[model samples]
Structures are given as structure tokens and as C-alpha cells.
Target: MKTAYQQFISREAKLADLPALVALEQACFNSDRLSKRSFKNWLQSTQRIFMVLEQGAEIVGYGLVIMRKGTRLARLYSLAISPTMRGLGLGKQLLIELEKQSVAVGKLFLRLEVEKTNQRAIGLYESMGYKVFGDYKNYYENNNDALRMQKAIRHYSNFSRLPTYPWYQQSTDFTCGPAALMMAMNSIAPKVTMDQKTELDLWREATTIFMMAGHGGCHPLGLALAAEKRGFSAKVFINQALPLFTAGVRSEHKKQTLELVEAQFAAQALQKNIQIETAEFELSVLQNALENGGRVVSLISTYRMDGYKVPHWVTITAMDQDCLYFHDPSVPDGHVMGFDCQHIPLAKEDFIKLSSYGKNKLRTALVLYPNFLNTSLD
Candidate 1:
């Protein structure tokens, strides 16, 4: 699609236009500029939406948005306007054009980051309905921070009908389970505190004592017990009754200790009225629970999201016809901050591949309900 303002028009960029695009990007930013090879790569990539604005056949502004492999969200990687083209509304026009391009490819949200000192750019984004969700310190080449921002590109979204999910970042690497649990609980009940004190407290409550290395991770039953103790209704789902993640530890004594801990967590869950289901979890069961006003904390393999080949925990808030949106407590690698972790819009097809972890493909999750039934998130 081409949008024109008299002689100023926007259209897709071609490979031959690489030099002009690179020149404009260099002229716009003093640091954190994209390499010429990067521009060429993006230009040739099928996942990239590259658009250039032209004034009387001269390239004046450009924007690039990239669609991820398995998700329904797009990232506005970069945008630039010629030095003389400032204040002509070219930036806004280019941004709008790029948003349309992203939506055309079935993306639900358009996310990006901008230098914090560039208030004009941030103002332009905010004025256009973008909201700042998180930030990254010392993100730019010159040590300037970047404010993470995004806008729901779709005019018709079903997210409003779902519960309001809060996002939290895990202070330490191993506390993802506790962090995800906190977000899920707070989403249903606002009284749930998310400070580091609560995070560490829950970790202390649920750790399995020995994992693949170092301190053990939180077991599914352990997480459920912690949630139930906090006055929320919880149901644990797992395929096998055998203790989960024993393969993570090689020591026979450590494995036995983990099994005993899991058994204790199981007994406590039963004593406290937390239900445990040992059947294989169908995706529809998880969706149905959410439809009936339940929050979920699930174990996922990070390989799909970042190739980490490790087990991680995340909270599931809601789902729409096209995508599954959740709050991940840990920020993914290769990112400046946890911006992309908040309300992440991943496709359902890919989520199935992500929700299971390790060999034997263990599937486990905890579905939770707030203390007071019918809690109004509105």
C-alpha cells in the first residue's frame, strides 16, 4: 500500500535502494545505527516489512518492521527521516504506514524501543496510541536508555474481555516460577504483593533442593501449594505421577530428595483442598479454564523462544482467536529489557511446542482462581 501526501509517498523498499536507506539511517542517529550489512539482510528477508517514504522521487524517510517466526507480533526495528524532512509530519506518516504493513501480515501488536532522550520521537509514538510498558538501561551505543513501547495494531481486539494480567521481572535467574506465580495471583487478586521479598519467600517455599545444577527449580505441585496457601484455588495437572525433573539431577541421593519433596508438596496440596489431575493435558482444557475465569502457570521449554534448552515458567492470562497472550516473568535473551515479556502474543500453534519441556516431554501446569469468586478486574 502506498500513502501519498502530495509529492511525499510511502512504498516498499527494494534491495537496490540499500545505499539510500543506509545513508538516511546514518544521518538520523549519532549512535546505535544499523550496519549496512544489516540493512541488506533485512531488505532480503521475507519476514521484514521495509518501507521508504519518497518526496518527488527522492527517498526521504524509511521504517522497518519484522515479524517473528512463530509469533503474531511484529517489531518496529527502526525508523528514520532525512535531516531536512523533520517536522513535516513524515515520521508519523511513515509510522502509520509501517503499522498497516504489520497488520496486513496478521500481527496483533506492533512493539518497538526508542532512546529515552528523544522525547519528540517518544511523544510522537505516545500520541499515536503507543504505551510504554518497560525499559532497558544503557541500551544505546552511547549508554542512553531505551523505553520499550507498543500499540495494539488491530482495531478489533478481544483482550478487553479477559482479566488484567500484571507483568513482573524475576530479579534472579532461578526465580521464574515464583515470579510467574506472583503475576498470575496478582492478575486475579490485586492484593498480591510482587516485591522481591515475596518472590524469595515463595522460592523458599517451593524449591525441589536439587536440579540440573545449583539450586533446584520449583516443581509444579510446589507452585500449586504456594498458590493455594495464599488463599487462591489451585488445580495441578501433570501426565505422570512420578516426580518431574528428576533427570535434571544426576545424583541418586538428590533425585530421591526431590521425589520426597514432591511427595510432601502433593500431600499438602491434598490436605489444603488443591486438586491434582494426572491425565494428559489437552490444550482445550487450559483454554476452557481461562474462559471460566482461571489463571494458569505453566512449565515451558525456552528453546522455542530463545534456544536456551532449559525449563522456564510463565503465566497465561488470556487467548483470542488468533493468538495466545501471556505474561513471562523473565526477559528473553538478546533483548535490552523485559519489554517483550509483557503480554507476549504468541500463536497457539507455536505455544503447543513451547509448553512442554525436556526429554519425555513433561507437561505440567497450575490453574488458579482468586479467593473471592467473580472478582471484577475492570
Candidate 2:
């Protein structure tokens, strides 16, 4: 007697299973594929859930759901099936499973991006009742545009009456891009005797500042002032070639504000004479600051596939021989509020090479000197 397809097991993924998942991802994606480190992060993320399908002890497929609180939508990050089993309805089955999982979590909508050129995949998505909501040009660097599709799972509710404290007031040890920004702004009081290890604390501080400032919920300049008061240095990285604003007053206004901030830092440098360095890459700027005998504090912007999407910010605090420590604002307070470093260490040369893969949009790192608030305008 043969076992039925329905008999194949499906279960939540484990850390030990990451190697197989990594192998499967490599088999399905190009060199620009998600890294093993990223896989580990996703596996450990509280906001994410992963499932795998197996047949007679062989892994055949996997799916991921990213559940974000304070928002009604859930994202289907990726769904993949083994090459040998592509034609079977396994992919559709995985999608159905994902829908069930997300709906159980109170999500009102499910969304995913499909390669526009993959007609077969697009057909599958559409047949499943997903409607094309938008087109993201060059969404995937390895491929062309991507079709942003959405499926309504429930009625939308207005967020006007919801309490803001539970979501925004919670203090996390480890932070993600958005939450870190809020904390950094709220916790700005001066400290004495800066810890040499404080550079390692850069992640949470930088992430909080950037997230709050960039989102317009808090003033960027005010956050910078608070960092100075708390004995932590700060800098804001701005790209000269964003191409979002043309030669006009809006562009000029942005440039002037950045320049004004830069002037304030320059004046601070003159007093303490602390060197502040800025670079296009977070790792590079931090490395430069360390080599020159200065601790680094930086704000880094996440890459933008489309301008309308939310961008993330991260901070860098300290660096050892190979690993750098900082905050990642995406995790809960227990995880994100403290200093963290790369689990997998990389050589300086290797880090530079890997960072190059996602260099499409303007990515800049702002370095700051800790302590002393100063104000300026230009």
C-alpha cells in the first residue's frame, strides 16, 4: 500500500532544520538569495512563523508568514517547493495553509509579491483569488518587476479609537527599526563616564532615533539633541543622489536641514575635537571611526524597493576584531533593547563584499560623537 499525499507531514520548523531550508532556498533562488544569517534571524523572530512540508522524511516545501502587530495586514514572505515536485499542487496547498495560519491570528489581509515575469506563479496566485494591487518596478534586482497582490480576509476597521500605550509604550531590550527610534527619543538624559563597550550599544539607540525621526512622529533634530544629552554621539546619514526630489525648493529645503545638522556636529567637533565620519555603508563608516580611535554611533536606512514602503533604521555601537555590536529595532523589548552582534562573524573584506549586493538605493551611515548638546541653523 502506498501512502497518500495527504499523509505527508507538515509542522513548524526548528533550528536544526535550517540547513535543509537554506539548501532548498539556494536551489530555488540565485546568488542574491536570502542569506543563512537572514534565515536564522527569521527563524528566531517572534513576529514570524515558518512551516515545512515533508514526505517520507524528505523536506519538500516551506512557507513563511510575518505577523506585524499594530497593523491589520500579514505578509507572506516566501513559499517554495522542491524542483522535482513543482507541478504538484503542493505550492497551492502551502498557500492555503498560510491563509489559515494568518486568519487565525486576526489578520485582515494577506499580501505577497510575485515576480511579474513568472506567468505560471502569477496564474496560481490569481486563481487563488489574489488581486493585483500594484506593480513594483525592479522589485527584484535579479528579475524584472514584481506584482504586489493582496487578498482581503476580513473587513477593515478604523484605528482611531485604539489605545496607543500597549503598542508604543512597551520598553524592549532589543529593538527593531521603528521601536528603537521611539525609545531613543524618550530616554534622552545625560550620563557620565561613557563605557568603552558603549559602542556595542549603538544598535538600539541609533535604530530608535532614526525610526522616530524619519517617520515624522518625532523631530530628527530633537532626537539628535537628546542623544547628546545622554552621553551618546549621533549622526544622520543622507544620500546626495536619492533622485526622489528634483531640483526644486523641496530638495533644497531637505539639503539645507541636513547641512544645518552637519554644522552643529562640526561645531561640537571643534570643542571636543572628536572626529565624526560618514560613509555610504554602515559597516564601513563604523570601521573607519574605530580605526581612527573613536567610538561610532550611526543611523542607517533600509533599502527601498518602492518609495511608498516603510524604510527601516539600524544603529552600530562597537566592533571587535570581526563582529560588530548594535541594536536591531525589529525584535521585542526583551530581545531588542540590548546590545547584539552578528552571530556569524565575517572578515572585513567579506562584509564589504556581501553588503554590496543590496546597494541599489542610496544607503548612508551617519557617525556621531557622544555627549554635549548643541544647536545650529543654516
Candidate 3:
């Protein structure tokens, strides 16, 4: 068999490569090895790409990338090289190939987690443009921590500036909207106090009829009205006029109440003459608002940051051509799989993925301009 460093070629992993991949997995890690079954599954999955580094008939390394259908980000599920192939630049070569494959499939960013103690791998990743974004405790089966790393493969623009703002975390799981609103409000109105009581009160005023669990989450209109009550001018953008959170409700009574609350919110928005637009907000609109000393509260699915399938609120503080910077109110889960959430930079397309919720990709956002100026923003 030819050595990987001697004359290596990269190709998609085929069924015949499974045995070699399993052997390489066993040889790479004492624990947390992917099984042959897993390799077969990944090889057959449409959302995943598994590739191998082959030197003639010998397979010496492999990389796996997992992507969601509508997301701009992909996760490097795993990478391994044969022990004898170490220090031969096979890992770097494999990484480069995987990133190319990810971008070819429409992913703008590629992220991964590696054992924190794996200094050699960390050095290789950093040398290859990957940056440590966060970490996870007890991430491996052997109880070893893992460091989260990511790199952008596609560049939308050259802009990379971030806005300065005070970060705030939601005290309760249901208060993400209010907490985000408070952060945006206090950042603009320095004299306003952003306390837990205000967070809860704003939530009380903005919460919808129900949530996927526990108390109902805040509605976009409700949050806009709450901001109006706080002396800020707010413009709303919603894809649908119907009440949200009606999808998962099992009882007709709950659905009816949700409809009523949504109607009330719509009525309040109209009464206040809040400029309501029924379309997906472009990046230019958000950029203009932020430039004019305003911030936006957007509803996103928690799936992108966390594994949960719930609507989440985040405050968009700044953006450049390449990335959108925001203050997420949720506390970071402190895991390799979870994002820091607060004051994080997301790729522009990733922000678009996170901004919409569910199968329909429903859009919701409230752009709160500086003060109480009832100006039409269309």
C-alpha cells in the first residue's frame, strides 16, 4: 500500500472504504470512535459528506461534514488520520478539501470541536485559519473537554466592524424577547435602567398566547408595542399576519386564545401607527437602522445556537458586509455544541437562517429607532 504522504488523492468515501475508516477511527482515539454502522449511515445521508484521503489503494485519513438543509453553517463531525501518517500535512489537506466541499454545498462557515488537550490538532486548525469560538466540558466519552472552532469559507464582503453595547442575559427561559428589547432600549437610552423587574414587566406586556413549553414567548408585535411604551420608535416586519405559536398547540382553546392575543397585538400596532411591513427585511434595512443609532430585535429559532426547536429573540447591534453582530439574551450553555450567544458574530447567511423559525421560515423583526419618532420606515 502506498503511503498517504507519498502520493495522496482525496475522494468521497465509498462503501468499500468503511472498513478502513473504522480501523482509522479505532487507531485515532482510545474512546469516542465512530462505528462502522455510523460511517455507513453518514455515507448514505444526503445532509452529510464523508471524504477520505487515499494513497493508491490505502486509505489513510477521513473527514466528515454535517449540514442542515437551509443553514449556511456546517459542522465538521470528525477527522482522523492514520498514526503513521501524522506530521505529513494529511490533516491540513483533509481540512482544506472538506471546507471546499462544504462551500460547494452552500455552507459559508465550517465549525468543529476537538479535544482541548489535542495541542497538535489545535495548532493545525489555527494555522489553517480556524479560530476558537467556545468550548465544552466533558465533551468526549473519556470526559475530556473539547474546544469549539470555526472558519469562514465564503466571504460576502470586506466589512468586519462590530458595534459596542452592554450585554444582558435573560433571567428566565421565556424572557428572551424582553431581555433583548431591554438591551436594545438601554443601549440607546443610557438613562433607562435595565433591571430584572423591567425585563419581567416587558415580558408580561409582550408575551404571546403560548410557547412550545412553559409560559408563552413574546410576540414581535408585542415587543414592538413594549418598546413604544418605553419611549422608543419601533417598526415591525412580520412575514405572516396570523398569530404565531399556533402550530404546536394541541387544544383548540389554546389556539383560539393565541389568535385573540395576536389580533390584539395587531390592533395595538395599528393604533400606534407602527410602520408594519409584510416582507423579509433586507440586510440594508437593518444596517441603516443600526447606523442611525437604532437596534433590532429579531426572532430566531433556537436550533442554530442550541438543539431546541423554539423561537428565540436576539438584539442585532451591528453588522458589516461579512457578518452580523448581535447580543443574544440567552446564557451560553457552556458546551461545545452550544454558542456563546451573547455578543457574538454570525455570518450574514447564518443570521438569515437563525432569523427565521420553523418549516415555513417565518420572519419576524422589530427595528427600534433611537427615540420616540413616529416616522414611517418603509
Best TM-score among the predictions, by candidate number: 1
Q: TM-scores across all candidates?
A: 0.75, 0.43, 0.66
How would you encode candidate 3's per-residue C-alpha lDDT over 1-378 as one tens digit per residue? 112344898888888887888888888889988888888888887877788888778888888987744446688888999999898888998888888888887776777888999999999999987877667799899899998787777866343333447667788878999988988888877666778999989988998858765898998889999888877888988887586678888888888998999899999989988889987668778888887877888888878655778888888877777777677787553222334344455677778777888877888888987654533221
- 356, model 2: CA deviation in Å? 42
Query: Ten residues in a row with the worst lDDT in model 3?
Result: 333-342
Regions more than 4 Å wrong, model 2: 1-5, 155-378
Clashes of each: 0, 24, 0
Scanning candidate 2 in windows of ten residues, the lowest lDDT window is 158-167
Runs off by more than 4 Å, candidate 3: 1-6, 137-145, 159-205, 210-217, 225-235, 238-259, 263-282, 291-294, 300-318, 322-336, 340-363, 368-378
Using TM-score as the yardstick, the better of models 1 and 3 is 1
**Whole-model Cα lDDT of every candidate shown, in order:** 0.83, 0.51, 0.79
Q: Candidates sorted by lDDT, descending order?
A: 1, 3, 2
Q: What is the number of residue pairs that collide in model 1?
A: 0
User: Per-residue CA lDDT of candidate 1, range 1-378, in tens?
Assistant: 678877898889999889898888888888888889988988898878999999886899999987654467788888899989799888998888888878888888899999998999999999999887677899888998998887889876655333446889999989999999999988777888999999999999999887787777898888888887788888989987777888768889988898899889888887887889998888888889998988888888988656677888999878877678888887554422466666778767778888878887888999998767534432
lDDT of 3 at 29: 84
Error of 3 at 39 (Å): 3.0
